[model samples]
Target chain A: MSSNSKDKDNRRRRRSSSLMYQEPPESLEQQSDQAVLPNLNAQWVNAKGAWLIHIIIILLLKIVYDIVPSVTQETSWTLVNITYMFGSYLMFHWVRGIPFEFNAGAYDNLNMWEQIDNEDQYTPAKKFLLAVPICLFLVSTHYTHYDLAYFMINFLATLAVVVPKLPALHRMRLAFLNPEPQPTDQ
Target chain B: MNSSNIGTELPPTAVAFIESAAASFQKIPGSAIVIRYIRSSYQNDPIRSLVELFLFIFAVRYLLAPAYSTKKTKNVHLTEDEIDELVEDWTPEPLAGEQSEWEKLENDRIPVIIGPAAPKTKLQNGRTVTNLASYNHYNFASNPELTAKAVNTVRTYGVGPCSPPGFYGTQDVHMKSEADIAAHLGMPACIIYAQSFSTISSVIPAFSKRGDIIVADKAVNYPIRKGLQISRSTVRWYDHNDMEDLERVLAKVVKEGQGKPLTRRFIVTEGLFENTGDVVNLPKLVELKFKYKFRLILDETWSYGTMGRTGKGVTEHQHVDPNNVDMIIGGLAGCMSSGGGFCASTEEIVEHQRLSAAAYTFSAALPALLATTASETVTILQEEPSIIQNLRENIRAMRAQLDPRSDWVICTSSPENPVMLLVLKEQVVKDRGFSRQEQEFLLQDCVDECLANGVLITRLKSMPPALGSSPRDQEKEWLPRPALKVCVTTGLSKKETEKAGIVIRHAITAVMKGKKWQR
Candidate 1:
């Protein structure tokens, strides 16, 4: 009898909604990132001799292109410039999140560009990354003898990669070309 | 061998190969430019050329070096034979460390029951004594109806499920028991585990991960502390049962997390503190959980089947809605006379634990008999609220004889609590100048004295700190004060309970005043 009455009382009382207690949902990307340990994908860029490896890679690429049969010096420099810019752009900016699954999707919404130095703009690593391409373009143009076609190709490749690293476009995504995927419910 | 000697004694094939390599180097286009550039860059400075060579070598070495180990140990290279010798020489320490004299004595002194535990239990020594140590508060263990149902279940389903719930082990009896418990607690869903001791420990890590935050009471039970440790979450402790301190800690945590992305935050505490025999302020906890946007994980193991008018647990007793708490973990072993535990929560949480909780997923399911017995016990508690009233009356009778009449000790338990914890008076402890260990010894003496006088009681057992933790790590560990535990049961009449309580009080007085125990 008492339990029956107690059940009635419980039914009469309005069950309090917990929605009021929940915090207003913000960008889940940032929130999920904060929920995990620091990202390791971008951290290697700050390690010892990490910058030197990029120059080594470019030199290796130049040598490889130069050894191709019947390739002129101008064509080799142009090929090196385009290849380096394309690789760097794909590596540093195009890839979203980490390749490793250890972080539990902590960096899923963040590209390597945003993940570098914890998304801090103008870090030393970022500065060196930005300078490498411009210097490469200058060398490629000088080596190409400032021919209009070769100069144009080198300059455009440099511009394509350098604009994304600017602080103004830190987290910007080209929506039409690369639409953000819907967040999967875990 | 010197390089000059090797050059002078070079084989004809090697010389021909070198000559061909040089010829090919000269044949390559831009070879003239590369030589010219090198000559100009060298500019009669050998250091510049040497530095360039060193840079090339350093880059190669850096790329070829093995990945660094995450562990902080130095990389010590050893020959295979040396490693074999080291392996042969190694002797592992014993799994369990050496037991102290007190531990060995306590192990020997443990009373072995000859039959089913009850108000009057026969010990291995062939003596019948009034039992107060077992948590048979309502004495439902020997109920004829429950026993009959259990026997029926065993006859129908055998002794065990022989598999975890995920496989073919989830029997109909288990589902009925889960439904009964969920309905009794007024929660949306419930999930049961095979054992009570590891329930919360498994439930904690299932939801709270490494980077989450947990604010727990300092006096939580051993299982809860272990759960917090296993979760690896950031833990902050507040003073036991102090609502103000809990509020302050919550505010401090919220302040510290400002501008950072929000992580899952939880406030963990117990319904009735098993060590201190006191109840938590549930309304205050719920309010603070809302105020700070933290979820509440309330462990009601000790208070679930013992508190409230209809045995709905602390939420019912304190008039707080069950939905307010995110998770409620309760033991069926304590008062329900069953052999497992349950967590009452929403359907989502219950479904989650079915797949994720370690004990539930890996351990075998509860026996069919225990499941039916738990279901029967929940129904009995709801239908017969007078059983709770009888327990409270026994508690009152026990307290009347022990609390005010005893001059050497005083009861620390709340009035409604059946587990009466009698601690030495503050003044008596101060005058005697007894350390924690000495007080524990005195309490053990009191328990022995009570048993000698035909009353069976126990002491509040304090858990040792976890292994591998340094002494400095235990500086902030909290231990309950030494006290004699007298768990009042409805199995004994009010008069019998009063008589047993008097025996407990006199036993404490005798132990405290005895010349042998005097400092």
Candidate 2:
């Protein structure tokens, strides 16, 4: 009976140790390390690029408005208007990649996941919150009717480009701020 | 003959057969209420049952009796001389270079009915014009010459096709007209149909089947929506200019339909939204089509002969190669001074549609004279670039005048193309002297006022679906807002633009003043 009890005890002990080994270790050290290693500079660069494009658009509108009044004759004004409008449109296509949203596959990778983890360390909601003001500003500009309806439409169209990137940007910041808890074998 | 001989040899059972037939006929009640009420007084409502009985009797006697051929025929043999006389009386001489005999008779006898005539003082004043509600003669103001031209062409072509396109109806002019359109569009082939609505309804269904998926803009033409509904295909609506929505829907389609084959994936959209008067992002749409591998169909109804460097369409305007777009469907109704639609595509698509599209195969082709007019118009549009330039200038001038008055007006998009919407406020709506029934009446009034002052404008009624609101709900809410869409054709002059501006401003001022005075 003692030998049989001993065998039972050994089998139980073996199963417990195997389960322990299979469980992933909980390490605060790794979590802290990941949280601290976010690429803040790259995030700022993207944000700056977005703002730069916005400024460039506003500048272009100003340039067109200034130049249009100087042109003499209705025919020349019409020509200049068409040229500026088409030019701006082409410039928009060149600068912002024609306002197309990126496919999910473009961001579906381990690097993106790591970026998201790092991003979480910063204010996760910052990008989305920022987009709200940008959208409102665009809507207001559209309502103001500066540079005709095309400018307003172009401004509204930027939302399509900006909105999709917000989640990715937010997730990147979140990933940097908050690392997910590791599994524990209790 | 054998059956008749067999019947004659049979024993005389006529009385028995007639009795049996009579018994069977009696089983079906002459009046249905008799059967229902007689079955049970307590089971059914007597009044309801009586109405149903009356309906049943009426249906049987009138509707069913017509199919049974109850009329008896008595044959009367006529001699050859009598037949020749009959033929002579029936055949009337053709009314060459003049009104038909029937039309002449109708014209002579028109005072058969009369209503309360216009006030005598107003009629006498001439300035206070009592006949303000007539559009037939309004053509005199818009384009008196156009009326003369139309009449001359009708006189030349005669009345109608008299037969469908398949049977001695495809005129040489029709073929040549479509060929000319194809050459102008730089498309390999084209098929012109009577109307755009019919063309879309017929061709869209012919292209795809139940197994296919049609990805269209949420704001496409109503006929296309109806066609997709009839096609019984999976229809996915991408958000307006939202490529991400399209991509997501495409991905889902691909995932769900992994191994199973689909017939076709068609993406349909307009080159320019006729209602909003905004140019579509065709290049972006084409780019998505290329990336997602779907066939694209563009309705360049509003854009043709108006947009692009060569007046090709939005595709040409955006510098997108037309070869990439699978099919281009366009209408020559508004700017082209013609009344028909054409589908410009490869020879294969044209052949497929010709064989399958009910609109093309069943409807009568455009009459010879109208086809000639369209052909002439195309030549004019292609050869005379100044027409388009003048149109562009007029558009710019109008926009420049209207834009500064931001409170009262808002131009949606694109001055290059000559469609503008004059959006009015709630107060302006009240000022137009229109009831809710005449929601379009205000715009019509503006048009009339414009015509009275010597500027012609064509107005469009916004479809309920395109308004992006349910009609029932909108009606209940008393949202009577309507926009006046002015489509400037190629012939609009600089003087006309200035005159139009003055007239539009005056109309708005008058309405506003009228409303205030009424209050």
Cα lDDT tens digits, model 2, B1-519, are: 134755664445865687777678678867465444346532334553353345345323332322221113387899999999999889675656476464464355322213322211132223332221221111122344544665676787665576667776777778898899889888899998887677777777777754477888776766667677655456878766577887887777667666553447889888877656677787778888888788998888778877876578887789887878888888766566667788889999998887677788888877665676667767766876676777777677777666556345556657775777666655544665555545454455565565455444545554543334656655533121366665544333566555566666676555545543233
Clashing pairs in 1: none
| Model 1 DockQ vs. reference | 0.03
TM-score of 1: 0.70
User: Residue A147 in model 1: shift from native, Å?
Assistant: 11
Residue range B1-519, candidate 1, lDDT tens digits: 235855676777888898898899999999988777666645454654564455345434434444322213477999999999999999999999998888887787778888898889998898899999989999987688878888898999999999999998999999999999999999999999999988999899888864578999999999998888666567889999999999999999899777555778999999988888889999999999999999999999989988899988899999999999999999998889998999999999999999888899999999999999999889999999999999999999999898899888888888888888888899889998997878988888888889899889998884667788777667657878888888889999999999998888888888888997786
For residues A1-186, could you state the per-residue lDDT of candidate 1 as single tens digits? 454565454333322422222111224444554557767788899999999998999999999998999999888988888999999889888887678644534565567887787777666777778778766764564344545566567768887987887666755566434543332211
Q: What is the lDDT of residue B241 in candidate 2?
A: 58
Residue-pair clashes per prediction, in order, are 0, 18
TM-score of chain A for the candidates in order shown? 0.79, 0.29
lDDT of 2 at B325: 85
Instruction: Give chain B TM-scores in order.
Output: 0.86, 0.64
Best by DockQ: 1
Where in model 2 is the C-alpha error above 4 Å?
A1-186, B1-159, B424-459, B464-481, B490-492, B509-519
Please write out the lDDT profile of model 2 over residues A1-186, one tens digit for every residue: 454565555446445644222112113333343345444422443464655654465556555655766643333323333443344333322231112211111121123212332334223233332343344332333233234344335444444333323333322212222222111111
Model 2: lDDT equals 0.57
